[model samples]
Target: MSEQTPALSLPLIQPSQAQKHVTHNEALMRLDALVQAVVLTRDSTSPPADPVAGECHIVPSAAVGTWSGQDHALAYFDGTAWQFLTARPGWRVYVLSDLQTVIWDGTAWAGEATSLQNLSGVGIGTNSDSTNRLAVAAEASLLSHAGAGHQLKINKSVATDTASLLFQTGWSGRAEMGTAGDDAFAIKVSADGAVWNTALSFDPASGFASGEAVQSGPADVTPGRLMRTDYGYGPGNVLGVVSENAGIPTGAVIERGSTANGDYIRFADGTQMCQFNATLAYISAGLCSAAWSYPMIFASGSMPNVQGTLDSDSLALTAPSVTVAGVTGLTVSGLGSTNVTLNVNTLAGASFGSGESVDLRVLAIGRWF
Candidate 1:
């Protein structure tokens, strides 16, 4: 007690402590007495929250994102991004264009430096589309208006042997075959013209095959004849003939039924050629089937008339039967008497049975009297 005589009692009220005491008193004060504007610093309704009493933070906001004086946005370069506010950090708005959007998402614009060579227009300009050209196989064929109606045209200058190739064309188009004088053969798909389905099929009586190549077939449908449209047996494929060989003569010269004018073979001159006298029969070069040396011998009346070959007898006729060595295709018809003497130079008749017959004629001319 004697050593502390120099020390005197000291008192200091700290400002921080006094402030804490006052705050505590305010919190505990009556609810009615609490100040109303005290919570304005942390409003729950507006964005960019109000800064707290001593907070020194910077928060982004609406007008700061994409707003300008008179426009929604303007490019202002802060030494780097020329006013690309929407693209700033914390914002995740993407863009659409020919690839790179210059204005906004879904805009028909492109970057001048990396995309369009040089283009300017309302929508996606011409040059902008070049970057997105169609791929090789990314096109639809047989479709109209494709590539804006440009067609796949085939022009023939020389004498084309269409027999070796099957062709097709655009919608309502035909592969036309033309000839100088006569076409050896001409058929567009199944009909005369490539575009015609079964409609161009000639009626049974319109015989118009001439001695010239151009004369046969359905005009432009004649082989070597000029066709204009795609030759489709149906609407999708080409003009091709299908043979089952299901029911035909073995030795018979198997061939396509030639159209002198259209589809149906015309009974030239007369539609009524009675199978008068099936003179002789023989096997041709092609084999008929797997069995027998050359398939089974055909019953005369079974096969339809072989048009090109069919001769009539003047009497008990004592001559060698026609040799159908390499006869390609054959057709047999009436036995009307022709004064043209039979000889080697003649293209012989394709025989049916001896008297095997079929009545020929369009009109209802009562049974051969």
Candidate 2:
């Protein structure tokens, strides 16, 4: 009856109107806790006992407490209770424990940088496959600088082990250089991989190099040697001495000695051509006392005419057949290409007995051409 019960009315407000404000305020409070949220922990499966207001965490698997059944979700503590939001694919989170950035890949979280257990092929700036496992494409590549005074060494297991760089033609080895059967450095070549021939070798101990002549058969192979400047004499001089298999003086084109007396040249067959101070002697007997006889034997092919002198220790005697002299003299007669004859007669026609001896000295000049 229109009567004023009290100064204000309590039942005048509708219940739905009051509930509407409460629901809107609750939604606003949840937004305040979740908008731009930063998670605090991802390691624990259960909610913290005393979580601060508006704090958030990533719910682990089989979560406990208010976070139960909300695995891999974002949990937000709204002062008294925890609220969870399901994680979606491509959601990124920073892992405080690992100090890495991770992203959700539909079902699980994976690091931004990929990690692989093993890989068959890897390529940088190129596509690589099984046959060429590791490939790189760049302008230049360098491998250097271990330390100062350090050497880059290619090592092998033993002396006979091969450690070398091979040059190839269409993926076939053509040449290689390194230690093949010993520590000595050698360069070898191959028409095919089955057979190889050493072209050059270097000795580490003597600092010498040897080269092999390229040939078809074993008999045609001629091994070469190198001599240093300080080998036979002092510095600034080099010498090479080649000898036959039997160590004879054959095939010597040039030979030199420290003194002038020792320098000479010879034919390949060890025949001397020109030499200084050569001597030849002859002794003859059974010469007619006043006649001539040829008695000299030459050791060369041909003999050149030469001036000589002769002497005898016998006394001269005159005969009835003598015309002008009481003494006899010896003269060279019958000179030819191979022999020489001597005459023991008086200057003016004299005769004497037989059985006389003569000594001759001749200066022979010739060649073995």
Candidate 3:
């Protein structure tokens, strides 16, 4: 037969003992100070100057005055003297100063419900479902950083999985943005929550964006889309080697090349031009003929309009004669897309003497596509 309670150390009356009333009364006093006990504070390191009867306090570490060497003990003042109770592990006490319940864990006291880790669900002002394990029904939710910066990341299990933020109106989705159904980022919109329209998308590897909302008109009436190198474009771009295409009144910026035959330029709108310069000797008085080949061939079945001009000193002077002959007329015959024949006539019906030459500049314009 033990003489004290195992849990609270409450004294028990001994059988066949003298003065049983004294032992019973001591047990009662102990019970009065302990059952449903409360302490004034756990922060006081010294005894109160004037403590009333039944008043108690949980003595903290390094206690001074009459409480020296009584750290972590429940100090109870019973009328004429003080009684100290040794708190055991898992003992709970209502702290009046802190207005909360604290529990002893052999070492120190701490709030009863401060640590809530590994909870399956948590709801604030709402009920949490299985899918939405942590639901917060509030006007706004803020996730701020502790020191520097913050990032809200939504990750998916696989590339084909969706991870996005959806904006809603009256519980109906209206807009969404993120990687949906694939790795590429996409922005989609819905009017009635039934039919969805992909307004924009970005490639994951190249980051190139594409959408039907991209404008393709010539005027600056709307926003524009990114231009592809192969797409047809109007003037005012870089000059490069590009294939010809049709669709607008404007043409390519400039697609040009040079070769032994002649230099040629083509545009997106099928416009082509060729320039060439050559020297010829007169076959007879007042006439000379030569064939001109284009550097680049034009579209088939297209005849180019040709024009020519003679250099200032193109008509050579006769060896013995000092008079200089000038060009009078120039004509193009046997017109073709790739080549043409040019004829030149000099003023005063002058002819180039033997071993003499005249310079001719020619221009031809037509279609290339």
Candidate 4:
């Protein structure tokens, strides 16, 4: 390991007599120059602080944001561990939930919508309000039917003042009012409507309720045909039916006479004239020669269809001779002249012959159907 190198001759000073060295700054400057040749500093002239307690270091606030191991990326300082905040993301403001997997509102978490609907579709049972009541599907009744009972059907739109449930054992399985005969069962009400009763009335023409009894007459009584029978009177056999529909309270009408009590006659305006009869017949002429205030339309609605007849028993005819026009039955005279010469029984098509020589011939032709 010892290799001897040649050195030029120099004056050898002994250790006891070394001369004093005076250049301290000159050596420091030379050491700095050598350090700058390897690692350059922005301010290499400034001296570093002591490594044990570094209070003398001064760095810009921006420089503290960076670091690199032992030497900070920027300036380093007293007891502070360097954090590179400017190079990384900032702190988060919003909160998140791991369990709910929703963005937290801090107060509560919100979710996405699932259902929305219109009024028609959101009704109780039926989608629309027109159907029956929306009840529990196939549920039992509030009061189960122990024996034979009825069920009430309800409407669907029972929101406000809806009606109560209507119950009916509706119609029974059997038919009513059989065709054998008229049982004559009828709904009868009291004078006041507070009470109603099922009553029966025997009809004579129906032969003990065998058929229907028209309020007009018995079966033998034909329209425009006069029959005399005492319902409950001595001379009340003088009964007759007009060919027109008449009042049930009133017997058949007859436009037979003239002046006031007449048959088949009309007021200035044509209405119907009739006699209401029960215990006794009361002659109330609606359509007469005079004006009737309230006029009713005849069932036929026309003059030719209006039917009437004359009977010598019901009417006291007092005329000598009256001429009836062929179809019109219009009499030229004889308003009211009672003599012993009037004959009411006559054949069809010629109730009275047209005679210009006569003053009046009990004329009645409006009775022709």
Candidate 5:
């Protein structure tokens, strides 16, 4: 039979051997240093100056003194002398210097992984609870890509569910941004944390945006409010009519209308104009008068300036009279906001019979408000 065991190379007692306890005690001593192994350090080249009995170390490369030529071996000090043991692959030892477990991989020692999957929680410099599964308490945290760019996404289960980043002060929410309470991306703010105001939101389908803080209409005129793109004159509503409620101009940029006798144009800036054609009948030599209503009335209590000139294509003279067929003077009487009377004067006292045609083009300009 062999004298030593095969696996550990422990010396076996021979039938005729005397002092067999020496070999048996040596086996126990080696087990005392190796089982559930721990090392004082894996980087000490020289042995300790005053090591206690039962103290153990893993001798490093280029070792000196009593540990010379014992690289990668476990050194155990037992009372008066030192003993060495060869380590094998799959041997695990707790390193005191690094406070971690390392395994021998035949060539070098490497850290042994404690756990890698299905962890209950992970906390770095902090304690994690059920709500916060992976919490990190630090000045900053980074999640970088292994290669190329990185993206951090927060997803929700449904459209009505919230997925947002909330900013807080003293644990009370002050602002938040994301898809909150709906699919639309929204930013909301609060002063007291109880009342929240939606500052902005975007439509998911059309990518258009709206908000409560945006200016509602042109009359809002308040400084520092966000302007809505559809507030005033814009695509599809250009030159559309504006409205007035109690003299306050509201709605689109311009207003206009056309009639058989005339046309009127009104603007958002309170300006208005009316243009029309009227026919006057010559009553006598120096007087021709006509009355007509304005297509659009000016603002109440305001009188519009009316001007007239004869249409060159629509003038006539009495058959038996020879008078210059041109108007020398034009004046307006009975003037009001909505109507006017036109008086035209021919060459003074020139003979012209009654009932002759004199077509005049009239224009009035004033305020609409």
Candidate 6:
């Protein structure tokens, strides 16, 4: 026998003719212990005290007793003693403790797939079928990192590709939001899935929002920004207001007063046309009566044109110094864009006595521009 030959080599060696059978029998016993191997346990570091013959186990690191230096090796018992074999990479064995198969890499054992074909159905914590391929029944599930931050990302192949989250009611689409058929982000809703309406959109290049109102801050928005609301004007459904205040700008405006019969339009230059009426107590030669003032200030000190009617209030035919008449003539003067002066004069072209009075009514129309 060659001194360099192992006792378990394929070609058996014997020291002499008498020991040849003994060597062959030993090799046969080693084979019988290892072929079609199934490990009894894979987690323990200590050897079993009463292992059955032909039983095998995987040795763990830092092992004690007879397995002390045989880390990651297979321990096979041949009825009387233990035998250790260094496992090669890719060797597989069924683990009785775990009811699974494990494969040996160069350094350790790892799980191996037991089946390779497709199956009709599979479930995790719940039942699944053809329509819903995967299902999980749990309060919550977490996808987290072992050492660093984690992120969940959805991607599309191109700019025009649709990547969106569709919200549904009973599997009927109700809303969707994302980059739909383009790079711009959009939020769309549908009464029925077939007819969709865009509720909001954002332009990537302009950084502007459209199709809806955009607001900043909780209550007091920043100055110079605009917030929108539905004005309920029937066709023009939206209107904008200054974010911080509601002062009207200096420009043309169509406005209404307490009476809803008509509207008045005023221009920035102080031009106006309005239906106005008033009654004035006039004693001829009395101090001019003040009636109304313009709503806006004029750029220049210009008076508005005036026209109106006059009516008599007293029925007396004559007073101490002046004769009372059936009707009195009314006129307006000192007409400023800021204020108008009303006066009543007798039809006989004379100033009336101090005790007499008349009523004045008018329609004023002019421009401050």
The RMSD of every model to the true structure, in order and in angstroms, is: 24.7, 16.8, 5.0, 29.9, 5.0, 10.9
- Most accurate candidate by lDDT: 5
Error of 3 at 343 (Å): 0.4
Worst 10 residues of 4 by lDDT: 278-287
Q: Please list the C-alpha lDDT of all candidates, in the order they appear.
A: 0.26, 0.53, 0.78, 0.27, 0.80, 0.63
> For model 6, where is the 10-residue window of minimal lDDT?
237-246
Q: Write the per-residue lDDT of candidate 5 for residues 1-369, one digit (tens) a residue.
A: 898777565678889889999988888888888888998899999999999888998888999999999998989998778899888898898999989998889987889978759988999999988988988889989888978989889999999899999988998999999998789999999998889988888899988777777776656757767876556557655578766666665666778997865899888778889988777767777677888688888888888988877555445433234333545545899888888888777664455466665667888999978
What clash count goes with each model?
Answer: 44, 0, 1, 17, 0, 0
- TM values, all candidates: 0.18, 0.37, 0.73, 0.15, 0.76, 0.49
* Residue range 1-369, candidate 1, lDDT tens digits: 231112211122245455565444333331211212111111112222333221211112333332223122222222222222122122211122122223223222223334555544223222223533422222343546766576545444555422223444443334433332233333334333334321122222444333323323222355554332232133332223322223321111222232221122112112212222222222232211111010111223332232323233321232233233312223323312221111112233433223222211111111111
Assess the local accuracy of residue 159 in candidate 1 as a C-alpha lDDT between 0 and 100.
Answer: 50
Candidate 6 collision pairs: none
Q: Rank the candidate models, highest TM-score first.
A: 5, 3, 6, 2, 1, 4
Question: What residue pairs are clashing in model 2?
Answer: none
Over 192-232, each residue of candidate 4 has an lDDT whose tens digit, in order, gives 33342223234435534212222235334544333323211
**Candidate 5, position 194, lDDT:** 88
- For model 5, what is the C-alpha lDDT against the true structure? 0.80
Model 2 TM-score relative to the real fold: 0.37
The best candidate by TM-score is: 5
